[model samples]
Target: MEKWAFITGASGGIGSAISLMLAQKGYHLYLHYRKGHEEIEKIKVRCEQYGIHVVLIQADLTDLDELQNIGRTISRMPDVLVNNAGLTHYGLFTETRIEDVEQLYQINIRAPFLLAQMFTPSMVRRQFGRIINISSIWGMTGASCEVLYSMTKGALLSFTKALAKELAPSQVTVNAVVPGAIEGKLLQRQFSSEELGLITDEIPMGRLGKPEEVASLVWYLIQEDAAYITGQVISPNGGWYT
Candidate 1:
């Protein structure tokens, strides 16, 4: 059977890597991006080199209407759904406004939860699916300045565990990938060179992780060989906060 995969936030570094990896694996892709058209286009060009069809879906995940409209935008139900789109707020908990909380909740938790609802029925009918939530190590260990981000990611972890059990009977696997200090645009945008340096020093591996490494783990989790690995939170953090 021809496989299809849907990845949210496919314009970003890690998402782009996962998109290319799935494309290389011969899956037709629906790459969702709220912005970063140029970046996403570049990824599409590269992914097409693998001889698979690629579709771009643009929607602001924070908007309920847009999120729901995603169902109508796809050609088919995805065999693999990677909930990788999220927003982060870095500040003291008291400094976080209601607007910040709402955005974080919508993108990080609500969007994924709704996407699961939109796609899981088809997966259940087919008795096969892979749902990978791209959570952060902060979700597990709780970062000081990113409290809201941590809460949302932590919710994803719990969602993964609960949904895995619910979907297990149908052989639809749900899992979370928790990465730490990945060398990506998000890190670059959020931290200074010196801060990143300090973070790297904390990691046992002494370097920020590569996007390809995380993508590789995601690819493995979606494979038939990994069917038994549901309800698991796998962290590829180079021993940071482990």
Candidate 2:
């Protein structure tokens, strides 16, 4: 039987890259996207070309009830769960509204936590599972004007570490992937042409990291060979942070 991977926010950026990589590896995919049905359809078609079963689901992860429903809908408990759905809010902390902060917490931290809580029991029963959370360098070294976003990701990093310990005895590994300034829509939106160029020059690699690069590490970490590794915040940040 083919192993299954359930990835939230699988429509674009890093999530899409991870899906394609896993498809190439013959993993059936349960792709969860909040919106962008058209883009997800494109992803579905591409995965089908690889002869992988792809199930696309649309649900806002901010809602706990929806997340539970998502857990119930999958045919089998996932062999791998990639909690990649997250949002970024930039601005001075004082200007950020209470509602925005709550939104960030709900989507980035609460949603992943609830989803893991709901699905991990079945994984424990199976005695084999991989939980991969797509965190960020901001979570590790805080970013100015990105305080709320950093807080949520920091919480996820903590969650990954704590959950890894709890699930270690069950042969389940939980880890976080911290990517720094990847070349994505998110990064593009955050930097102007000159600013982005300067940022790239600052990295030891002299360029922004690619989404595929991040996905490749995720692919490796979920493999049987990585069973002994857990509670690790693996950073693929192009030497952005030591």
Which candidate has the top score in lDDT? 1
Clashing pairs in 2: none
Instruction: TM-score each candidate.
Output: 0.99, 0.98
Q: For each candidate, C-alpha RMSD in Å?
A: 0.6, 0.9
**Best candidate according to TM-score:** 1
For residues 131-228, write the lDDT of model 2, one tens digit per residue: 99999899999999999999999999999999999999999999999999898887778789899999988899999999999999999999989999
The 0-to-1 C-alpha lDDT of every candidate, in the order given, reads 0.95, 0.91
- Candidate 1 residues lying further than 4 Å off, grouped into runs, are none
Q: State the lDDT of candidate 1 residue by residue for 72-177, as single tens digits.
A: 8787999999999989889999998999999999999999999999999999999999999999999998989899999999999999999999999999999999
- What is candidate 2's CA lDDT for residue 110? 88
Report the Cα lDDT for candidate 2: 0.91
The residue ranges of model 2 lying beyond 4 angstroms of the native Cα positions read none
